[model samples]
Target: MTAYLPMDREERREMLASVGVDLDHLFDSIQESQKLKKTDFSGLQQEGISELEVVERLTALADLNKRTDDYDSYLGAGFYDHYQPAAVNHLISRTEFLTAYTPYQAEISQGTLQAIFEWQSYISRLSGMDVSNASLYDGASAAAEAALMACREKRLYKVFVSAGMHPEYIETIETYCHAAGVEVEVGALNEAGKTAEFPTEKGYAAYMVQSPNFYGVVEDLPLLVEKAHATGALAGASCDLISLALLQRPGDLGVDIVTGEAQALGIPMSFGGPGVGYMAVTQKLLRKMPGRIAGETVDRDGKTSYVLTIQAREQHIRRERATSNICTAQALMATSATIWLALMGSSGIRDVAEQSAAKALYLQEKLLATGLFENTYDSPVFREFALTAKGSLDLYKLNQDLLAEKIFGGLVVDDNRWLLAVTEKKSKQAMDKFVETVVRLAQAQ
Candidate 1:
């Protein structure tokens, strides 16, 4: 058998000797009281199994998971259930793209750099912004980072976020702001499902709102932006990228920073993870944007090339001076989103957005027809909406009943209100079955 460490006894001895101590001698300085004679990993150590046996065990464990493919799912809060094109996986899985790391050296990393550049361009065009960073961790972090950027750019310590934003995103912003010594204030949502009140004082750095927010209601962004501007604060929004296809661009509404989860683009809802977060800003805020930005240039040989430009991450510069402390970009995931956008083009994306909206409306109509559920808010919505079950039919019980029918129901947002989402991937027959199941559950109650 090959030695895992790649060192023979003699070589190991020589290395330890050069370090001026043997393994035991190296640990001689440790206090006897703090040292352990034997490592006790109780209950965690398992008996060794053969390779085939291990595979079988893992397969058995994996089979316990309720996969989306086998069940009807309406679960979309941030992560979605869009159909990823086969070509997206095929192209992204290529060795050159999949295994590529940060493209620090432009000469040897042209392919990766170009891919990132394209990703940035796609996001910029979709967002109607002057520029976009390579990518961030996820929607929550991107929103948090955007708040920080706003604070830095406007030179203010206070930020105002709408109560309509995703709860998780709000919590994340609070954590990031607390650490940065910035103040975060959440404004209330009005009857029209829009952020209503704003501080009359002119000390806020930015006003952040989410359209098709956690409740899936489209906020009045134009009016919101105007209010922010009146207070001399930048308007930032955490948006749903797919919804942007059918709605007015935040940039066109006078927003300074647009950040959103790109999961609905082409990425899967792989158990709520590995989704790319995109951040785009007006030209003036480009330098303060977080993460890597790829730029097109000419090589010494006069050939077009791509390179990392405007990297404001802490690793590349002084920590205090860095615009953001995000260590890396979501290169692979961003590439997936880029490929999805390229494949879909503008028309395809619009078609998807339209289909999702139509389906959601259809579901809403179907549920309301049965008199089992009613709309919680009367506002323009895109692919998702909130509904309240009539009578004593609890959302948790309904979800459990749905599980029995091999269907996953909408997420429970409030006490009897459920947030349901519809994607283009859901078929008419499937939606009908889901509606039938809900109707039956309602009747049972």
Candidate 2:
């Protein structure tokens, strides 16, 4: 379809007249409350400039927003600045993989299907589940879908999420459930920063918790799963893909559903997106899973082939009865994850996770030694932890100071509490500098 853009006012008017439509009719679906009252761009006008000059101006503008190398960001709410191996991008950028669209013909799109199959296998192994779908928008949507999937078994309509889950994920589940008349109950986080029980029992289909949760504290997966099952609710555990290398697998903990953002696996942060969400479940719940699931099969000659199977649960076939409305998702990122996993193998991945945890513990101890901050929770954590800053400390001001020093401070949870995260990427010297910066800031305060 051609875009009906008019180069001149006369052409715009003529097209509107020919279509028997006014500007209002052209955008009739936009609610009055949702529409902006006036165009803000109307006041922004610039004189004629050459295309080269405009390009130069844009380059300068981009530089202004570009973060300098000196700044070390510790922020990771949903997105993290993990190191992505060059091979990951090189493989994903292959012409066939980069340009591929959704595979509609199972027979002809074997390459795409095979990649999805590998993605499913990796996710399944990581979560300790029997099966996984291709991918989803992100971790939050995946969590929401897991809730709906649990509802399929018992026809219950409520979802219980722990406050330890990323707040954004909790909000995403609520947004999805509201339209479906599914109530969401959020449980509180205990002093250990793990999710506690809900005040009252409700007919919930699923209970979602996060290990190495939003506050950077790990939850008690075995106990949490047991409690959820006692109420006949499915237990869904969201985890950091990298952390699973050291921690107990969600499936090993007896979780029915496991899902999380896979960005830390291999993909770049990419400004918080284009990240894939991985979901895996026991084979017993496979039929209720959403999104495209690639399966392996043989041809008439017994030659191996890959195909997308069991898709009747999706929107096009099931309509309102569909498991989910998610159609297409981050296949390219999923491919990146597959390549990264293959490159690292099991041992290499485990080393990365262990090294990251060690570095984080080193930083935690150093920070506490300064007597300016202390660990907020008493539980064992992964690569991230909550620290309580002392004195008349202003997080915004401290961050500003850290910015000037070319060091990114930890994420501020409150005026006095911050969440710090470390990875294999940061070296000993950098970690020392970060600690020195924090100590100086504390002394000044």
| lDDT of model 1 at position 384 | 90
Candidate 1 Cα outliers beyond 4 Å, as residue runs: 1-47, 312-317
Q: What would the per-residue lDDT of candidate 2 be over residues 1-445, giving only the tens digit for each residue?
A: 3445546767777778897877567678988898778856656665668979989999998777535244687766667666778888888888679888888787779999999999999898888999999999899999988887888876999888898999889889998888888888898887888887653475889888998898778889998788888888889998898899998899988999998999888677766778889899998998888888999999999999998888753465666766677877689989988999999999989998998899889988988898877779988888888888776777778888888887777778868888888888888998898888877876686
Q: Ten consecutive residues with minimal summed lDDT in candidate 2? A: 62-71
**Model number with the top lDDT:** 1
Q: Write the per-residue lDDT of candidate 1 for residues 1-445, one digit (tens) a residue.
A: 3335677778878899997868667778999988898867777746768979989989999999897888899988887899999999999998888888787878899999999999998888888899998899999999999999999998999999999999999999999999999999998888767787878789999999998898889988887789889999999999888888989888887889999899898798878889989999999998888888899999889999998776633455667666777868899999999999999999999999999999999998888888887888888888998888788888898899999899989998767988899999988998898998888886786
Provide TM-scores for the models: 0.92, 0.88
Measured by TM-score, how close is model 2 to the native structure?
0.88
CA RMSD of all predictions: 3.1, 3.8
Reference-based lDDT, each prediction:
0.88, 0.84
